[model samples]
Target chain A: MIQIEQISKSYNAHAALKQASFKVDRGELFGLIGPDGAGKTTLIRILMTLLLPDSGKAHIGQWDVVKDYRKIRQHVGYMPGNFSLYRDLTVEENLRFFASVFGTNIKTHYHLIKPIYEQIEPFKNRRAEKLSGGMKQKLALSCSLIHRPELLLLDEPTTGVDAVSRQEFWQMLGTMKEHGITVLVSTPYMEEADLCDRVALIQNGEILEVASPKNIVDHFSSHLYRIKGKERLGLINALRSLSLFTKVYPFGEYIHCTSDEAVEPVVISQQLGQLGMDEIVIEAALPGIEDRFIELMA
Target chain B: MDSIIIDQLTKKFGSFTAVDKVSLRIQKGEIFGLLGANGAGKTTLIKILTGLSGASSGKATVAGFDIHRHVEKVKMNIGYMSQKFSLYEDLTVRENIQLFGGIYGVSSDYIKTKTTLVLDQLGLQDSAKKLVKSLPLGWRQKLAFSVAIFHEPKIVFLDEPTSGVDPITRRQFWEMIYAAASQGITVLVTTHYMDEASYCDRIAIMNAGKMEALGSPGELKAAYQVDHIEDVFIHIVR
Candidate 1:
């Protein structure tokens, strides 16, 4: 439903987005996955018509982002990374205000946000500022959906949220997807990439890769290994010093070591095993979206 | 050898108990991870330990100073960095370093030397004069961390310091934490990134204002019969 063509934006000397281009199918859940300052926000703002692009063009559905800004704003729902609800107003008041701004009432589109709104309904009387981080986000999402916009844009909604809450937020997005809403979301978390139908990995104002999560992993050509040892830092240093591994970084319970050429697991085991380290385990592993992103950036 | 000790610490707001008699001990040169959901009293507990707020009951000592009786002393012994508040966006990179150094009561000469050291270490010597707002989020976060520990405090508390940062910068930030802990600095960190729990020497999962689980990452996983710390966290909080 959205199309971007060579969109470029810059702040003085720094380029926030450079020749960025992507497309989102109607009723599809598309993710713009990148770290902070990776131009995810800038791209979203350009599509939302809040910021003018320095060059190129973008369209939200049938309307051009620049020529039809008014129409785009009316049909697009945006939840900024920073919560933009009326902090001094109560939760109920914020929802009502957003609905009124769109020339509608809460009851007109109550079903659109029912799944998320009901979670924070008991705290309807609480001030927006007084709610917890998770609750505030839910409230923000509810307000964004109050008018039943066809397109939803969320910028890093789960960036700082805990695991369980992040999961719940994504589930809400899933419900929106099932409702045939075109959702364009951005996040710095790579694990969440799997939740999207397709994700474009952007970094340093560049769109490095775009594909389904499974396809991105399938494109990983290097031999990756999962190595675990008793000492974390020591093992990383040892692997880095070997010069044989293309990449080595800590990944949860183990260190992910990648090499262009396939190497035997026994070789790594024997090398670190001589360093007086105990309980060394090494196994060939599959690359995740994060590992692929690092490789693309490298 | 303990850098922090807590005995049934409780923080109550009216009839609500944000921290319900929570107890924990962190050793010198250890990387301790604090894992919890939002409003799980992690921030409240940190505030009490850092002397920003008072505890309703319980006893706690940070860096050998009692939090209740020697709040000022406790403040001097610890450093804190959170995602929401860290550095002045309007100030230059070097000025922020010097400003924090002055706040910690360091001498002008030491501040001058450390400022250069920090800029060089972070490879921001060219951007030292640039306002902190001009830097990328990753670079800004690294500078904030360096400034937080500029005074050489005995303990450092990081509350989701890498929340919105990328995977690569997040790892580099952890490298700095590893370096600091090796230098005899105690690090108490909270992160929403569950993979990070494995990086800590020990982790404590708090739920409903209480310490629900505390152990090494491996131990917690084994106890909960899960392969990942995220699973352990869900098992406790969910």
Candidate 2:
């Protein structure tokens, strides 16, 4: 379990955090969701003992992040967004390196990372930098989990990798959650929010919203519908041109339009039908977390 | 002007070809998204255009300068932010800005004025004096971006600059990018975020060292006849 109380941090005159507070229950895949400067990393760093908080405090289980920095590092596995393992070392070597860092041997926790580690076992002799992105990702994961820490702090672990690799990496995290590692992840992907147990949306050093992904969408203050039509760009233009819509964003094959008033589907049909747009299909749908966050920010 | 032109550009490391013979033209003032899976060669292609790495037996030009012949010119005309934060943690946030501006040959007076503008734009004017080490990751990322484009490069290469950043900040970062594009800066960014791909005027999907598809978000969707870019990728790769 993690308890954070009124944590605020500032470097020079800019405030990266402004008394932001949240807590994560044990076994929770708590997501710190925010934009570029929301202080997610600052908070993570403070909790990991990588940086000192200017004020406020956080407790990792019973250990204080500041007063007991050394102890907390033992219980947490942190995979920074860009921190790769030793590039010059082989896969086996990297695994050994990390295991030693936690005062354990790779054989001791080999079972924990076996499912992922096996994928790169053949390349065990290859240097880490020589492995594929997905392979490297797996290797990084194996290293972090080798010690079997109670808490896992991953900072944007899937930034530049391929989509499928990103998917696979998250799936691995999902499996890790079973061990109840008290996972805390920070990501800019709104789509990834659903994967978390609960997410706190942060912006400009402030918390905008915190709720389950579904709850966040349910809290959306507007009616949502997905509209598909011929000449999609023209249709988006037409819809955006409308004065009655609250938001008209292009979503995949259709444009998800939000309404201030419950506009009749038939009214849309009639209007587009008159414009020679009979191919239009409108479906009432739920708003996603990204949409809600955009709405909130707007 | 077609700001970027790559003809049969390929990059190989020993027996491994990171980027295949890829050719494409990116229009001026367009927000183009480079998308792919891990090890799909997006980063390698970016390196080639920026002249960070040499292409293997192919021609690549960025902003009308030959990548091989005019490497310095290429660097001068582009702002590049790697996937990593790439900021020296030892420097202060303001000092980092000044350092990058100096690298880009920004005049002292211009650096002062432009630094003020960028810091204000990113809402980091308050942390201008904070050491980069003490800054949060998200703030460090934004400051890194401002540093990359200090000289107002014609094209800015953002290699997942928003990675690990919060969703709200990601949106804000995109707004800043959108604003830059609106000002006629050609933006070529690489990201795995599918939603971010949707914001691009056009997108190029790469897989295993080859360009799988390239077009506007809607066009690629229509061509693949898929509902989402996620699905479109499935259709393409499958």
CA lDDT, candidate 1, residue A253: 68
lDDT of 2 by residue, A53-166 (tens): 888878999999988988888889988878579999999999999999899998887778889999899999999999887788899888989999999988877756666777
Candidate 2 residue spans exceeding 4 A from truth: A49-57, A66-71, A82-89, A129-133, A225-259, A264-285, B1-18, B23-31, B43-189, B219-227, B234-238
Question: What are the DockQ scores of the candidates, in order?
Answer: 0.63, 0.25
- Interface quality of candidate 2 as DockQ: 0.25
lDDT at B172, model 2: 50
Worst 10 residues of 2 chain A by lDDT: A229-238
Candidate 1 residue runs with Cα over 4 Å from true position: A125-127, B107-113
User: How many residue pairs clash in model 2?
Assistant: 13
**Cα shift from native, residue B46, model 1 (Å):** 1.1
lDDT computed for candidate 1: 0.90
Candidate 2, B186: how far from true, in Å? Answer: 6.4
Model 2 quality (TM-score): 0.72
TM-score of 1: 0.93
**TM-score for chain B considered on its own, for each of the candidates:** 0.97, 0.93
Query: lDDT per residue, candidate 1, A120-200, as tens digits?
Result: 999999999999888999999999888889999999999778889888899999998777899999998888899999999
